[model samples]
Target: MPKLLITGIAGGLGRLVAKMARSRWEVIGVDRDPWPSAPDGVVVHQFDMRKRRFEDVFRTERPEAVVHLAFVRHFRSDPATRHEINVEGTKHLLEHCAEYGVRQLVVVSSSYVYGALANNARYMNEEHPLNASRTFPEIRDLCEVEGLVGTFLWRYPEIATSILRPVNTLGHSVHNAIGNYMKIQMVPTVMGFNPMMQFMHAEDLAEAVNVALEKKVRGVYNVAGPGAVPLKRALEEIGRPYFSIPDTVAHTLINTLFSLGIYRFPPGAIDFIKYPCTISDKRFRQATGFRARHTLAEIFASVAP
Candidate 1:
């Protein structure tokens, strides 16, 4: 079996991907956090990707492929370190991949990169420009990482790089912004704005990654679950009661609470509830014949409090 290295193997989605990939590839895991419950055959190392010891894994193990999942998602702490791990860490990772001759790379990005805009297409394609920072500037590092990976994809076609922009992910283990928001009591909504949303189970996303790696999918593609739903419907499906308010009041209250460490997401996240940022996964589905297996009901069930 070819060797595959998974960064952020301690994470929920990362662990799932590792389990799914282990059958076909000898899996090596890397993360700053420890994974004591790692699968029997997999060897996990605790190493910060931005540090010197991280490169040692590549030099020693020489993985044939890599799944880049190491990122600071919640952005509530040390902004500087978060930037280093997300943006600067990716820079070094790309350099290492090039130097180490890794044959394939799979980067898991978020559909939020498309940005929730009032004028957004019902379903954005890969060609759509990433303008997420226009409102949600907090995730600029994610955009920067994707930009770096996007450039690397073209600059090193021999590497067979693929970037997946998956919709909001929710599961029993993963804690994404959407999941955190929906899990809260009395979730807030922008008045008269019921944006469409796309959600997928973390397991389905893990399978998507497996298919991309298996088929060596190259280029950027959007990944989605079976269907899209209105924000109201999504909240209802998850048994989350949301109260609608004017955008001004909603943003202010959320930001204030966030500053006091009461809210999980930033104020800019209001745009997502106010505007749709759904994406079409036709390109990915066409390229690898990958279909999300989890139903919307299952996806919501995993996030229900």
Candidate 2:
């Protein structure tokens, strides 16, 4: 069986992908934390992605494919630490993938890279400019990571590099800013701004990765679920009570709360609730012949209290 290496394998998405890919490949997982119970037939490595020892895993496993998902998403993490992990760690991973002759590299990115702006198109596509850093400096590392991977894809045609930019991913096991925000008893929103948002189930995303590896779908693809829903409607569907506050007051409150460690989302995330950054998955669907099997209601139910 071909060897497959997955970073962040301890994460919900990574574990799901490992389980799905196990039937086809021998799986090796690397993460910063140890798993209480790792998946069957998968080797697990616990360590920092930035450590030079990471390359040793590449030498030992000699994986034919790699799925990179070790990015830090917590707002409380030091910005410098996040950057070192997201950007520099990715750089190291890409370098080692090239050196080790890895045939396929799948990098998971977020739709937030498009930047939530008042003037954004109704449905941004893959060619859309990544302006996320213009407002959210914390995500700058992610944008840079995409850039580095894009350059690597062009410079190294031998490696089938597939980049997936997925929208708000929701699932019972998944822990993300949007999921945490939705699970709150009382959620917050910007006054008079109920932006349209799209969500993808973690299972669908894992399937997309599997398809990419199986089909060698090269280039950037935007992976989205069935449909879009207004922020308020999403809250209502999840049975969460949310009140809107003026944008200025919301920003200030979020900033203060984030600084005090009372809130998990940063102030920059306010724009996501204030504007639409919905993405089109036409390219991804066409390339992999994959469609999300879960409905919007199912997605909402996954995170419901």
Candidate 3:
């Protein structure tokens, strides 16, 4: 069986991919946190990605393919610290991938890399410039990571590097900004802005990663669910009532809540609800012959209590 190394194996998506990929590949997982138990054909390693010891995993495992999902997504860490983990850590991983002869690299990125701007097209494609930092400064690290990976992708054509920029992924196991926002009993919305949003179930994203590895899909692709929905409709479907507040007032309240430790998301996250960042999955579907097995409703239901 082919060997596969997955970073961020403790995360929801990483764990799912490891479980799903185990039957087909020799799976080795690395994360900053330890897992209680390793899945049936998988081994888990606990260590920070930035440390030199990370290379030890690559040296020993010598994986033919790597799924990079170890990015920091929570607001628990400050921007500088997050940058070290997200940007610097990914740089380290890429350098090791080149040195270790990893043939295929699948990097999990976010649609947030494309800023949620009012002027955004109905469906942003992979070629769209990453302007997420213009509004959400916290995600600047992610954008930088993508840029660095893109440069590496071109610089080394020998490695089949596939970057997946998935939209908001939701599942009971996934704890993310959108998932937390949707679970709120009283959801907050910006006045006069109900953006069109797309969601991909965690399983579908895992399947996409598997496809990228199995097929050696090269180039950047956007992975999204079957369809789009208005942000308000999504909340309504979840049985959450939303109250609209002016942008300034909403930001101030969210900032205060963040300062008080009542909210985990930063104030800049409000832009996701206020503007659309939906992506086109046509390229991904055509290249890999992959379609989302879960419908949009099923995605929401999976996360719903």
Candidate 4:
């Protein structure tokens, strides 16, 4: 079995992926927090990706492939720190990969890079230009991160870079924005506005990452489910009530509540409301011959349970 190194193993999706990968590969995981348990046959290492010394850990492990997932995940709270970890830390990892001759890397990215919203007709293929104007700070940071990773590939064509851009990953992890909303019963289904929603189960993402490792494809690809379900329909399927407040009202209400410190939304949550961002998985399907096995309904059901 080839050795594999996965960052952010302490995260919900990382833990799930480590559990699945350990059965076949010699899985090694790294994260800032100490992993609570080693999940049977895997090795977990603790390290902050933001530090200069993080490269030393990568050098010592020298795994055959890497799956990078560690990130600050929020830009509004602190733009500087978000860039430090998401972009600088990614550069650290890629620098080490290039130095050590690591052949394959699958870095998790987001569809927010595509921008606020386009007409539903746009399939969001891999060729779409990354969103500009710094529309949302979170995506603005991702645009930087993605460009940095792409540059690494450009510099070293021999090394393959696989970018997985998944939209609205719904899974059992409480850390995910949408999943957390569902957990706290805070997600309000808008009746009048039903934006196209695309999601993948956590298990499927892990499996897809594993497949990326095996296929060794080079270039950017969108990894999402087949169909785009409406947000209202998605909430209804999850057994949640739908309330479609008018566009003006919804914005005012959320902004007012947030101003009072009564609640907090994800960094790009509000911008996404109007954009209805959705991505296509056709490129990934053609590259790796992989398809999402679970439906949004099934994944939401698991998360709710």
The best candidate in terms of TM-score: 2
lDDT of candidate model 4 versus the reference: 0.75
What would the per-residue lDDT of candidate 4 be over residues 3-104, giving only the tens digit for each residue? 788889899878877887786788988898888777766888787877765777667777888889887664345557777778888888888898876888
Q: Quote the positional error of residue 211 for candidate 4 in Å.
A: 0.4
Q: Which ten residues in a row have the lowest lDDT in candidate 3?
A: 34-43
After TM-score superposition, what is the CA distance of residue 3 in candidate 1 from its true location, in Å? 0.7
Tens-digit lDDT track for model 1 on 20-97?
999999999999899998989999998778778889999999999999998888867777888888899899999999
Question: How much does candidate 3 score in TM-score?
Answer: 0.96
- Cα TM-score per model: 0.97, 0.98, 0.96, 0.90
The runs of at least 3 residues in candidate 4 whose Cα sits more than 4 Å from the true structure, single-residue gaps closed, are 75-77, 118-120, 132-134, 189-191, 256-262, 266-268
Clashing pairs in 2: none
State in Å the error of residue 239, model 1.
Answer: 1.5
Highest lDDT against the true fold, candidate = 2
lDDT of 2: 0.91
lDDT of 1 at 67: 96
Global CA lDDT computed for model 3: 0.90
